[model samples]
Target: MGFKKHLSSLKSYEAGKPIELVIRDYGIRQKDIIKLASNENPLGTSKKVIKAIKKEAKNSYRYPDDSMFELKKSLAKKYKVDSKNIIIGQGSDQIIELLVQATCGSEDKILTSSLTFAMYEIYASHNQAKVLKTKDGVHNADQFIEIYQKSKPNLVFLCIPNNPLGDCLDRSEVYRILDSISSDTIVALDCAYGEFAAYKDKNKEIKPKEIIKKYKNCIYLGTFSKLYGLGGLRIGYGIADSNFIEMLSKLRAPFNITNLSLKAAIIALEDSTFLKNSLKNNFKEMKVYEDFAKSKNIDFIESYTNFITFMLPKSIDSSSLCEYLLKQGVIIRDLKSYGINAIRITIGLREQNKTTIKLIDKYLKR
Candidate 1:
């Protein structure tokens, strides 16, 4: 049997370690495990979203509203955009796939930060498109502009407050890059962690409507997985010019989103008390990680997201540290694959954070 030639070049994405896997391998009790690996909401699902999902569970037998009208309309009113400007996906990840399918071909190129999300390259590779990264490990507008001028990639991904490593490109820096790129290049501005950034600093908010109105080529990607605690539901969206939204929608399979997911996301958007409490607790807990790093004199990025990345000292091996933590029933991300000797941990609940800190201290001291 033969596969597509390009499939040989891609490696499967390694997600966070699952608790059940740890239980089997390390023989740890399920109740003892904590996962700070995937940047999931530590608060768990919101009460409002849970109730809505339960109410909609009986309707799961029927197909979802393929149009996704209500959810898009809800998102539109919140962002002050028209319904046509929005497109829903299984997750913002699916929208990434749709954008790649619509814009990329074997002859095309996709550009992104050197240390950003892995899926941009993975999806681009599925189409055999060339992937280009900035020379700088972190997102630098100057480097992006230089690379864009040289490669003229068909798609550009800007992961705002980027995943794995949580620093962000400022609003001004983002505009500068958008200004430099040609309208022919479709830029996917992924704001998966935008809520955390906005909570920390009002100036850091990436306004989807503002960007869409200013740049016809720009598409803003957002997810319920982060702040909304809807990772399990997997509902996300893309906001762009109605014209671009139409083009992407044509590539989408009918009913890609489930009925329960639609209900959960619609209510998730309106659960203001949950949203506010989650954000407040997020930053409040984030400080614990920051201070922990400072106390150890470890170098860490000034994160604008819910997670923090700690650049370990030469004596601390990221993989070894992660393995040690795994045995103790704690799960966190290792960035060696990202070509960095660091670890990324989600800002968990107070007790989870305390247990993680205690375990790390034990490891470092050992």
Candidate 2:
């Protein structure tokens, strides 16, 4: 077995467990399992997008438009960017892998926050790039610049309103970090939660084209998985200068996105009604988790994203709390793998959110 020595140690990215798996494992009825683990749109995929997907499914025999011309044009219009600046991927996961494959030599390094997305490290490991990560839970641009200066990594990643923890830093802070870092380094900002982030009073807006044009080395990543309720479709993209996009395009697989996913993404993008409602629900329901945490004296990191990660009281073990919720047929994410003893729950529908909190409280009382 002459597999690359580094590949053996790389762990696959663990996704939030789906409801079907949870139901089967725990012998719970399907409807009874309230899955608040993944930061998915609890309102569900748009009817318009579903219709588009079904309509396009008949054309699956033919390969996807290899150029993905129309979809890119739609995204370009949506972001006010030129089509050449956009590169769609099967998911943001592929874009990250493509970045690592394109830039990292065996001896180069990839850097990110210690507990941000894991795919950055997983992909870098394949190239045998030394993955350097800062220990801060939140993104502090100055701190990242300090680490980057010492390490001089070839690729850098920042997950906005970062995964699991949901902490965020605004564009001004991002600009500071970009200015301090070596201009030659490729900085990838994973804005997977940007839509949820767009409406905030502060730290809400980022001009990706402007950022890329000024920095020249930045790739801004976006996804339809969260707000668009298209996780099952597997569509995501990156925006950067045309030159950078052209370089990365060489490494991307042909027909990287499926036909149905592409069509649905276009429909989802055009459906302003669905997008508005998803954002509205996320902003309103997220506060309930915050208020409930305070009332229960449960410690939590403040979040701008659709999920809230809160810690159980010291008297209660994290696993026990999770298990209690599991028995009650409520599924959520545990952050032990992220090295934090907390639970991250998506802002589900009002009833689901109510049930999750009530059962958690009942478990505490027991």
- The candidate that wins on TM-score is 1
User: What tens digits encode model 2's per-residue C-alpha lDDT throughout 28-99?
Assistant: 999888988878899899999898888888999999998999999999998888999999998898999999
User: For residues 1-366, could you state the per-residue lDDT of candidate 1 as single tens digits?
Assistant: 588876776887889988889999999999999999999999999998888888999997899999888998899999999999999998899999999999999999999988999999899889989999998767899999999998899999999988878889889999999999999999999999999998898777899989999999999999999999999888899999999999998989988999999989999999999999899988898899889889999999988999999999888999999999998899999999988899999999999999999999899899
The runs of at least 3 residues in candidate 1 whose Cα sits more than 4 Å from the true structure, single-residue gaps closed, are none
Best by lDDT: 1
Q: How many residue pairs of model 1 clash at the backbone?
A: 0
Candidate 1 deviation (Cα RMSD):
0.9
- Clashing residue pairs in candidate 1 (N, C-alpha, C atoms within 3 angstroms): none
TM-scores of all candidate predictions against the true structure: 0.98, 0.97
In the order shown, the candidates' Cα RMSDs to the true structure are 0.9, 1.3
